[model samples]
Target: MSDIHKHIEESQVTLSELMLPSHANFGGKIHGGYILSLMDQIAFACSSKHSKYYCVTASVDTVNFLNPIEVGELVTLKASINYVGKTSMIVGIRVEAENIHTGVKKHCNSSYFTMVAKDDNGNGMEVPGLILDSKIEIRRFLKSASRLASKKHSKFQETNFEVEKYISELKNHNVIVDYKGYK
Candidate 1:
């Protein structure tokens, strides 16, 4: 283990479980919240493995459920370190559900979790740098960087919001803005 860095592959974590009836929601499908919990667990495990320190989830960037998970299907979550900052790492997770009888798999969701390493004293600790060894790893690292940049830009836009400028943009979407009583 290099003191300063670790390969992304070395920190990958995969978890798979058979979906049980108890995991389903009132609609009779697996609940999104349950899958998110599993994703968070794998993110913590992967980040801690890479950083060699205790870590906590800073934020979950996105959780887009592409497909619904069915009860009795096998669900798998694969997590890997996408990018690492001084004390933070982005864990990319891919979720898939498989039908056991048919051996068919469908992508359920993809999420990015940001985790920050902490020392025993609960202070932020420096984490090992990521070693990108493959194209996919490099792409993920770039994607994480781009995502962070976009988030910062969005924050700035929100802070200095202009309703007039967005009115034209909102026209293209499913929005109806009445200017008479608008803030």
Candidate 2:
């Protein structure tokens, strides 16, 4: 709602850390939760920088882990504001893992997090608009807007869903209907 606008680069954040054995899972690969925690931290930093206020995570969109990170690999996470509403921003994060020996990097995960700026009293505060300058920035903003619309539509469908109408369809799947009252 603020008249002030800022560029995407103004608030971008990147974090890199070497993956340790303690951060690995029993399978020897880095734990997904640890990476997620890192992503959240970067998202928070990026959004807070942009808004100039304390920000809290509202939601996180699809997180797809494409590659497994190994112990001793260097993991890098990049976060930027892709879109902004009156008081909320969608932060896009990209995670990559690099081999220390070969210097080869692979895309590990991509996620979108919705963050809301908050005031000292814990109420939502208005955030500055984005000044998208490049085609890529505009594309990212449009995609985030589309994704938000799709999420709203999905929620609407869920709210209006009728279990009785779809109950019989469950039989076609792997689930078993054991209740006697639904006959």
Candidate 3:
């Protein structure tokens, strides 16, 4: 294994950018898409560092816009590889915006991105395992990791006939399946 492949055991990518006038929307607030682009880049950096190959976003489970980031604040993007599959890895991202003048910080968004590692041919490729180190990081990772696993299971259930039948039966038994947009 190459030295660059050690990204799984412990890795963190941070991006600091001053609030730019170009990044703001008409209301003078930074757009979610702008933040999302930074998040995506951070996630991909971490993933590529781990796999030492190119990766692409397979899915973004949910993106919550917790708060509006005003202009003139510092936006920081953090991303880490939390879980790995045969050919996919789940990255946990937390976006925080800080007012440097006031020292006030608030979480702007939180999201999980799944990346599919591929060879030059675009076929699925395996990735190494991930190791959790810190207590706080471990706790946060557990929450996101659980969601990642559940997301995969739900996707599988949708594609498999037996799982769909079971879900239907569970629904008949009054189990509520949360409805979400597929696209």
Candidate that would win on lDDT: 2
User: Model 3: per-residue lDDT, tens digit, 1-183?
Assistant: 222234344556788999888999988899778988998999899787777679999888789999999889999988888777777778888999999999999998988898988899998878876555577656765776788668667845644645433455565575666745321
Instruction: Assess candidate 3 and give its TM-score to the true structure.
Output: 0.76
Evaluated at residue 80, the lDDT of candidate 2 is 96
**Backbone clash count, each prediction separately:** 0, 0, 0
TM-score per candidate: 0.88, 0.91, 0.76
Model 2 TM-score, 2 decimals:
0.91
Residue range 120-152, candidate 2, lDDT tens digits: 999999999999999999999999999998878
Total clashes for model 1: 0
What is the per-residue lDDT of model 1 for residues 1-183, given as tens digits with 9 covering 90 to 100? Answer: 236878888999999999999999999999999999999999999999999899999999878989999999999999999998889999999999999999999999999999999999999988888778888889999999999988888833767986765666776798667678455
Rank ordering of all candidates by lDDT, starting from the highest: 2, 1, 3
| Ten contiguous residues with the weakest lDDT in model 3 | 1-10
Question: In model 2, which residue pairs have backbone atoms overlapping below 3 Å?
Answer: none
The lowest-lDDT stretch of 10 consecutive residues in candidate 2 is 155-164
Ranking by TM-score: 2, 1, 3
Q: Compared to the true structure, candidate 1 yields what TM-score?
A: 0.88
The 10 consecutive residues of candidate 1 with the worst lDDT sum are: 174-183
